[model samples]
Structures are given as structure tokens and as C-alpha cells.
Target: MAMLNPMPYEFLGVRHKPNLNNFFGFIYAKVTVPSSVKVPVLPWKDPETEDTIYPRGFFTGHYFSEELKAVEKLGYKVECYIGYEFSQQSLFNEYVNHFYEAKSKAKERWNFEFLTKEEAANKMFYTYAHEVVELNENHLILVSDTTPSRELLEAQDTDSVFVQNPLPQDIVGSGLGQFKDELK
Candidate 1:
């Protein structure tokens, strides 16, 4: 396929500082997708351990960018944020904790199914991405590979669809929590 714009995905800046709530208006207008989609899985049984392997379906990064644009066009200034190494501490600790919990649940719910390390990791990453996306349809958080938060500001790569974490702390600020609260 022909390449689109320099960065087909764009986020509208809501305010000086990133806030989850800031994207609400944009999300209402842009983020629209089915609650559930059929995620692909590979059926495999390890001869050595007789474990069933399950893999999640793949999604494209452009899909996320499009979603964000939809919201931005509706009138929300958002920007993609990425979390990298921090001098203070590991930003991903909280996200890692959640991933473990979610992975455990997935394994149990799938009847003790097994997935390759890569498969498991990808599934967890996508799960978190879905959660973040669900939280704010307008605000787009592109989780790139490790670098620095500042470096992500100039990033223009969309070779992959999975958004890695720990995402920029600001991406899930009060806005996301507020959305969760409203849902509750």
C-alpha cells in the first residue's frame, strides 16, 4: 500500500499539560469500534509438555492512529505520549503488576492454556493497549520501544500495531480515571 501522510496518526493538544479528561470531548467524537473483535489464536500442543498455545490476533498501529484522528477532528487537541527510562524510577512497575494479574486471569480462564513467551507478552501488551484505548477514545497514547519520553515526541514510526508500555504517566492522568469513574 502507498504510504499516507508523514504521520497519518495525529492527536490534538488539549492543554499545556496532558490530562485524560482533556480528551473526553475528542473521544466522544472519534473513538468508535466494536466492543469485541475476534482475536486470532493458534492451536498448538507442545509435544514435550503437551501444553496448548494461544496467541492473540494482531492489530495494526494505524488503526489506533485513525481512532485518535477521529476524535481530534471532532475538536480535541491531543498528542501521542510515550514513557521511557526515567531518572526517578521504573515507570512500568504498575503496568507490569497489572499485566501479571491479567495474564494470570487469562491463563486460568483459558483452562490452563500455555503460550510462548512472546505470545504471552504480546497478548498482555495488547490487552493493556485495549484498556487504555477504551478509557479514552480521543486521547492517543503510542507506546514505543524504550528511549526517552522526550525522544518519542519526534518519533514517526508505525511499523507495529502493539503499543508497548510503561506508557507516559501523563497519558492516563485524571482523565482516564474520570472515565472509569463515570463507568462505575
Candidate 2:
């Protein structure tokens, strides 16, 4: 949940600062600002002529979606600001607190019921995630000695590996993608 927070501009598609070169984040919108209208000096405004340069191009790094909505009401075509809205601080804080409480109180371990050896092997082969358990940033415990190998699949189709948490019980979570220990 912390990683999914939009603070990391590149990862969550929400840039903290304005960027005009590329629409890497969801902050920028492609609009057509008219020359007839009187507006403030924006980033895309022409320095000498004081006119809108990119009439039908992206203008980025300045205004929020609410301000852009006002522009849309002025007969301008604005795209990519409808569904996205910046979350209120209190709402975001409540969401974070809920997840924190859930994680802190969770006492169950990850149950790999109905997981086949082949599926486990494939996940390991692609993501290098051992038994789908992320231990820490730099260290992860490999669940099986012979997983991701053809020998495990050929042995039994129903066969699967079990993961035992070697770390302290206080460091475990009951949900998927939760930390197995201190996230450092």
C-alpha cells in the first residue's frame, strides 16, 4: 500500500513536479487553449507574442484537475482529468491507518492451498519470487530446494512445496504482498 502511494511519480503515474516533455504522469492533460480568451501566462504561452503556442498539445506541471475542470467548462477540450482526483489528506490518512492496523494485528501465515508445483515453479521462473514470499529488500528465503526445475513438475502434478516462516512470528502478515520482516 505504501508503494502504491502516488509519491513515487514514475511508478504510480502521478508526477510531483510539472513535466512537459512526456506524459509520464497523470498530472498533465492534452488540451487546446484558444487565443481569443484572456488567461494568465502559462508554461506553454509564447514569450514574445503572448499567445498559446501549443494550441492542440499537452500543457503540464502547473494546475490541478479542479482548475483544469474550469478550463473544460470554457469550451476547451480537456482529456485525462475526469477520473483522476487528488485524495484529501484526511481520507488518505484514514486509509493508511486502516491498513497499518490490519497489518499489525494480523497473526496468520500465508496458506498455499490448491497451489500446484508447476504454477509455483512458473512464478519463481518469471519473478524470481521464492514461493511467492518477499522477505526483505535484499534477502528472500527460497521455499523449495528443487523448485522451478523440471524435476519437480515431472515428479507429481499435484505436488507442491510448503513454506515455513523461519523469521519471528511478530514479523509475519496474513495477507499477500505483506512484509515478512522489517522492510529494510
Candidate 3:
């Protein structure tokens, strides 16, 4: 799917907020695993109850503060990156597949050196999913494979890209976010 480049005029016409209960786009941090520790765990604090729990990996950056503190307390390393998450399994899979195809097509069609910087970045976006990791039992985490895999419990970022306007009638149901996939 071609990327949407909504201009300033488009933003002026938008009336409703996009529902982001299902998508996540944010700055993500993951605790880096050191060779000394065979298994690394994330110390997460529940804000509502103020209880701390350790999870294998987190799905989003909502716990940025807690995570930073936990890593500092443990004397461990943490790596941050731009990440995207999808709660719905099918949507997540679709996103991964879409980017993978775009990356492949770009490699086949153009030499990276010839593309402008922005064009290179757009292509890089396609390559980011090669490191996607399904965490927290049901959610998926997307990153670049060149980086280490995430190993923390689970969390989700509330911020996301939402369609500010309605899709055409013919494409309403077929539009992005229209296809709902329940967690299994």
C-alpha cells in the first residue's frame, strides 16, 4: 500500500479523532541483554496498584520511566528505537507483510545511492520489520533485525496514526483500521 502523505489542508478538514485502541507508534526502549546474564527480565511497575512485576519483555514504551529506573537499579543496558505495535494479530501480520514486500521491490528496482535522503528513509521503513518480535503472548513488536531482539514483558503505547477523515464509501470497509481481528 502506498503511504499517505496528508497535507496541512487535509488536517484542517478532519473533524473526528482516530480510534487508537488497537495501534501503537512510539519511541521504544528495550533492556539490553548482557553476556553475564543468561536471562534478562524487565521490572515493571503497575501505576494503578503501584506494584512492581517482572516480565520477559514489553510491547511498547509506556513503561519508559519504570524501565529506565529498573535498568539503572540493575546496572543493565537499555536500547531505544522507533517502534510500532499492533494488538490485532492479522493487522500486525499484514503490516509486516506489506513492508517486507515494499523492501523487496525497492531493492529490485532502485539502487539506494541514487535515491534522495527522504526516499531512502521511506525505503528504510520497509526494512524495519525484519526484526519484528511477537511479545507479551499476543502482541507484536517491530524493529530492525540488525539490532538485538527485545526481551521484556508487555506494554502498549496509546499514541498512533489515525485516519482523520472518512474513507470513500466504496473503500470504507476495505480501508485501513476497518478490518478488525480479535485477539485469539
Task: Give the alpha-carbon lDDT of every model.
Answer: 0.37, 0.45, 0.42
Candidate 2 lDDT, tens digit per residue, 1-184?
A: 3433333122333444333233332355556666544433234665678776534444543445545555767655555542322332333556666765565455234332333477567556646643555476434225343354333232322322323434456545544435333222
lDDT (tens digit, per residue) of candidate 3 on 139-165: 333343322433331222232222434
In model 3, the runs with Cα more than 4 Å from the true position are 1-39, 46-88, 113-184
Write candidate 1's Cα lDDT for 1-184 as tens digits.
1121122124333332223332322221112223232322223345679676532332211113333555445443434342111112244556655755676787679766546676577568657765632545333343333334434243323322223334455543323121111121
Q: Model 1 Cα displacement at 38 (Å)?
A: 51
**TM-score for every candidate vs. truth?**
0.17, 0.24, 0.21
Please state the error at residue 156 of candidate 1 in Å.
35
Name the 10 consecutive residues with the lowest summed lDDT in model 2. Answer: 151-160
Predicted candidate 1: what Cα RMSD to the true structure?
22.5
